[model samples]
Target chain A: MLKIEGLRVELPGFALQDIHLEIANGDYFVLVGPSASGKTVLLETIAGMHRVSTGHIWLDQRDITGLEPERRQLGMVYQDCALFPHLSVAENIAFGLKVRGRPPSDIARQQERLVRLLDIGPLLARRTTRLSGGERQKVALARALMTDPEVLLLDEPLGALDPQTRENVREEIIKLHTELGLTIIHVTHDFEEAVAMGQNIAVIGAGAIRQVGPADEIFRHPDSEFVARFTMAVNVFPGRTEVGPAGTSTFVVADARLLTRSTVEGPCWAAIRPDSIQLVATSSEAGPDNRFTGQISRIINKGSVVEVTVDLPPAMTCLLTRHGFDQLDLAVGRPVCLVVPPAAVHLFQD
Target chain B: MSKHPGSQLRGKSRGGGQSLNWVFTLLGMLILLFILVPLFKMVFLSNKQALGQALLDPQTLSSIGLTIYAALIATAIGFVLGVPLAYLFARREFPGKGILEGLIDLPIVVPHSAAGIALLFVFGSNFLVGRGFKAVGIQFIDSLAGIVIAMLFVSVPILITSAKESFRKVDVRLEKVARTLGASPWQAFARVTFPLAWRSILAGSLMMWARGMSEFGAVIILAYHPTVAPILVYQRFETYGLAQAIPVAAIMIMISALVFIGVQTLLRRRDAGA
Candidate 1:
């Protein structure tokens, strides 16, 4: 297991607040945040690149916060791959062993294994500059893995590739992680990438982690307003919550009332994921549940999903599949009923 | 109907820009002629008898040899000491960094005679550094040591500036990757950074050596006995007439042209191959 406690790093005009995280052995954890949210800084710090102000990092029960990057035994792959241009692919892959003074036989053995594993046998003699993006990424991965580090840190490894190459390299990295069972910490800013690759996700905002859980939990039940907005839970309303006589609660905004399962009171923010809300015809909207009658203010086609904006005194956005959108024959200025389940309305204090 | 303002301006610029290209070419050709005419005349005007005599004279040949040798030594010393300092300037920021960088360019702007006097203050026989060296039976005044000191003082800035630019061109992330791959700091530099930047460093060294070989005022100030090629040409012009000086000047010109062409061809071929 790798653990970080009270991690704080200060840079000019930016600082990472006290951060604590734990990754179990052989687990795939993804740190997701927007640009300059301190994701790369935290990864570099864990790799022993930056100086820690007040922190303790333990890897497999050994204190390694003060160790050098080479002594820390962590593999790192950057977005650009950063393959040494001076060395050919074969020499680049063997650099770690060569620097360590390992025997030629041992170096050749490991080199052959990685070459076969990554299917880069033909590229061994080629220069790094001649390889394509996917080829370069694979070679960088093989080079990092040659050292057999205890943990692998990938800093947006697929951020620089084209769409098709990104997909191919993404699968290649997943295969490597599964085959080797290496503890991996991947950092990225793409939401779909985080959901697709990470077994556990951590959402960071403004240099502090806002939420950490399974992908579904973070998507459906964000713990803070920042997490909700970052995760694209678009229908968040600032309101005051009043506990009802029963177990449910009523969140009152300017002119709309939202029923939520949360029992918390006082001023708070209520988030309802766009995908969780359903659109029904206004004529049959007779149910007494959480339903609001509103006019469709805008219809935006976002490729696979359609974003429908409605004004129920307060404008709300809802997401629907293309099939559902086509079936509903929805259009701008049309009246519709929005059904938001009480369980879907997550409330959190400021 | 009036034309759109943006389209009218674009049309005017397009026509004017093409005519301006011809004017630029004319001005550029004038400067090229100004530089090449004198050099070409000097090389082509020398008679065969004087040229043969200049090559046969031991004094002229030895001065050329000594100039080349001292420049080589000074360039070697600069490479050993200046590369690390260049890397530091390229990669790190500390107190007085801006001033240090400005100071590296000092030798370039200062007059060669003034620079010679400044070196005399610090490295003269009575100064601290010169006295310490004299204790080891080494002297700088009117000797090969003094020639090398003058050459190095005037030429090292070229080397450091070029090397620093080369280091800046190399991505620092490459070294970071090497460190994560189990290489120490020094090993990362040797295996990664040095190889990437060595081409530019060599190009810079060639320039520094060429500049040092042609230095006149500084070397004359420190050592006039073991003469360099430029000083020999001057002495020939002063004692004899311009006729005697042309042969030695032509020989130095030939050597400079050969070295310059060789370095340029080498750099071009390497770039093409890479």
Candidate 2:
């Protein structure tokens, strides 16, 4: 496990205020945020690139904060796949293992396993400059894993790949992570990538993480408006909260009302995942369980899904599937009910 | 207007006629003529008899031989020392990097005669360095070694500059990767960076050697007795007039140009093969 504490950085206006996190062995932890959110900076710091102003990093219980990147037994893959162009693919793949002073036979054994795992056997003898993006990324991953590092830090390893190639290489990275059971702290601005790739996602903002939880939970239960917006939580409705059951609160959306399971209220904000909202026609609008009424504002065709933006009362939008939109067959000016099940409602303190 | 697409495209480049292009072609010819005229005069005027007579004279032949030998020695010394300095300038950052690089380049801006006067102050037989060296049986004043030192003093900056540019073009990631691959810093540099920059270094060395060979003022002031080819050419003109000087100048230019073209061709062929 790797742990970081008090990762405070004094930037011009913001500080990375006391960042504390832990990654257990075999954990695929991802740092997700938009550009300039300090995700890359934090990852690079963890990778032994930048000097932490005030912090201690522990790798498997050893204080490695002062160790050089090469000595830390940590492997890093950059977005650009910084492969040594002067070396052949075989030599590149064997780089870290050689650095560890392994015997020739032992190096060969590790090289063979990586070659098969990444399926780069034939391309091993070729110069690195000739490798395509996917091919180069594969070699870079293999090289990183050759040392059998305690943890692998990937800085948007697929940032340079095409869509299809990104999917393939991402799968390769995950498969290696599974096979080696390596600890990972990957960073990316790609929302779907984070969801698909990481088990535990930290929603970072400005320079600090607003919330850290299981990817699905953070998506369903964001703790702040910043986290809400960053996680692609599309429907943010400003509202006022009133005290209710035990610690629970009732939120008053504009021209509409909804109740969350938690209550800390003055001026409160509520977010609903687009997929969390169920669209129903006027006949089914008679239910009273957290419902809003509005017209089908627009229909946007998202591949295999249609994004339905509804100007419902209380004013909100949600993403429903093409099949869901097709069967509803509701046109503009057509009235419908927006249903956000209370369990799916994420509440944030004002 | 005819709607032929290709013809309209051609018309835009040439205004549908060749008049403007002809002017451009003539302008290019004039530019070439401006450069080639001086080069043409420098060659083709030297004759075998005059050159033979110059080479036969002991003073003239000895000076030409010493000039060639000293330039070679100085170029060799620069190759050994300048390459590392070039690499350091290109790769490493330190305090006073700009000033150090500028100081290395100072010789290029200083006049050759001024360079001779400066060297005389430091390495003269009566000066501290020259006196110390003389005590050790090594003398700088009026010696072939002094001429070689003067040549190196003046021309090494060019070698360092060209070599630094070459080393900069080489991706530093290659060195980093080599280090991660278990090669030591020296091994990585020797195995990779040196080979890649070798061509540029070679080209730079040739240019420096050519420059050093043509040096007159500094060598003449420091060690005029062991006259180099340029000084010999000068001495011949003083005693026997331009008739003697022109042939030696032509012969020196011929030999230097041949060497320059040969090395350049080799560089081009290697690049093309790669």
Candidate 3:
């Protein structure tokens, strides 16, 4: 288990403050945030690359806050795959073992294991400069794993690859983690990647973690407006909430009222995911709690799904499958009814 | 179709660009000729009999040997002392770093005789550093030590500047990754950073050695008794005029050119292999 308590790192113009997290052994934890949002800094700090101002990092019940990176036994793969350009692939993978002065036979054994694990045998004789982006990532991963580090930190590992290559490598990395059952902390700004890879996610913004929970919980119930928006909750509105007669909640923004389950009754921001709002023709039967009739103002075909914008006083975006969009024959300037469930609107204090 | 607008414009531009290229080629050839003419003429002026006699002359041979010996020592010293400073200049920033870097390059800009005078202040027999070394029975005046100190003082900046550039080209992230992968700081530098930068460092050292070999003014002031090749060339010119000096000058030029070409060819082959 790895635990960070009250971790504070002060950089030149930014500071990550009071970071607290506990990652269980064998758990795949992800840190997700926007660019320059301290995600990489936090990962580097965990890897013992940065100086921690006020904190204690406990690994398996031992305080390792003052340990050097080598002693900390944390492997880190950089976004650019910082492979040693002068070394061939086999030498790069065996670098850690060689530096530790392992016996030749032992080193060879470990090298064989990692080469087969990463399926990089064919690339063993090639220099790192000859590898493509995806190939470089694999070599970097093999090199990082050579030391048998307790936690592997990946900083935007798939961020440099093309879309198709990224998917392939992403699957490979997931398989590597599962097969080894190693604890990993992967950092990226892609929410879909976080949801796909992480069992638990920490949403970092500015310099602090806004929320940390299971992937679905953080996605469904973000603690702040920043978390909500960063998680691609595209429909957000500043509003006030009032307790209804039956202890229900109603959020008011501009001229539209949204039914919500939140109990806090004051100025707030109501966030709704684009996929959660359902658009139906006016002739269809609609529920009463959160039904608004609006004209379709925009239509965008996004390969798999279509994004439709509805002008209901405050504009709203809804995602629909291509088949659903074709069934409705949706077009701009057509009237549509938007159905939003009360449970779908997440409201938080401003 | 006969006169497509874009094709006509492209033809005109291409014709203009070709003329500009010819002008640039002519100017480049002129400078190349200016450098090659004197060197080639000096070699051709000396007959093989005179060149063989100069090669067999004890003084000429010993002086050439001393020049190579002193330059080698100076380059070795520069590698030992300047490489660490180069690494620091490449990686770290501290107060007065700019001033220190400027001080490293000061020898290059200062007049060589003036630099000899500056060294004499600190390293002359009666001075503090000289006195300290004298306690150990090592004299700097009119000694091999003096010759090497002068050459190193003048030529080490080339080594340090190029070494600093080499170290700066290596990504610091590679070193960080090495450290994380069970290597200590020194091990990381030795295994990763040094290997990556060594080729450039070798190239820099060769340039420094060449510069040290050609150094004359500082060595003349400090150790004229133990003559290097350059001082010998000057001395022959002074006593026996240009006729006698030309043979020794031609021999030195041939040796220097041969060494330069050999090192360049070796480096090019290594680059291609890599």
Error of 1 at A52 (Å): 1.7
- Per residue, candidate 3 scores C-alpha lDDT tens digits across B1-274 of 6468999889999999999999999999999999988888889867779888998999999999999999999999999999999999999878999999999999999999998888888889889999999899987888999999999999999999989998998999999999899999999999999998887788888888888998988998888879999999999999999888888889778777876786687567547746
lDDT tens digits, residue span A64-157, model 3: 8999988989899998899998899889999998999999899899889988888889999998889999999999999999899899999999
lDDT of 1 by residue, B217-237 (tens): 888888887889999999999
DockQ each? 0.83, 0.28, 0.82
Model 2's DockQ? 0.28
lDDT of 3: 0.90
Query: Could you list the iRMS of every candidate?
Result: 0.7, 3.7, 0.6
Q: Provide the clash count, candidate 3.
A: 0
Kindly list the per-residue Cα lDDT of model 2 for residues B95-131, writing each as its tens digit.
9999999899998889998999899998898889989
Chain B structural similarity (TM-score) per candidate? 0.93, 0.88, 0.94
Q: Residue A172 of model 1: what lDDT?
A: 95
Say which candidate scores most in TM-score: 1
Worst 10 residues of 2 chain A by lDDT: A282-291
lDDT of 2 at A103: 98
Which residue pairs collide, candidate 1?
none
- Roughly what TM-score does model 3 have, to 2 decimal places? 0.95
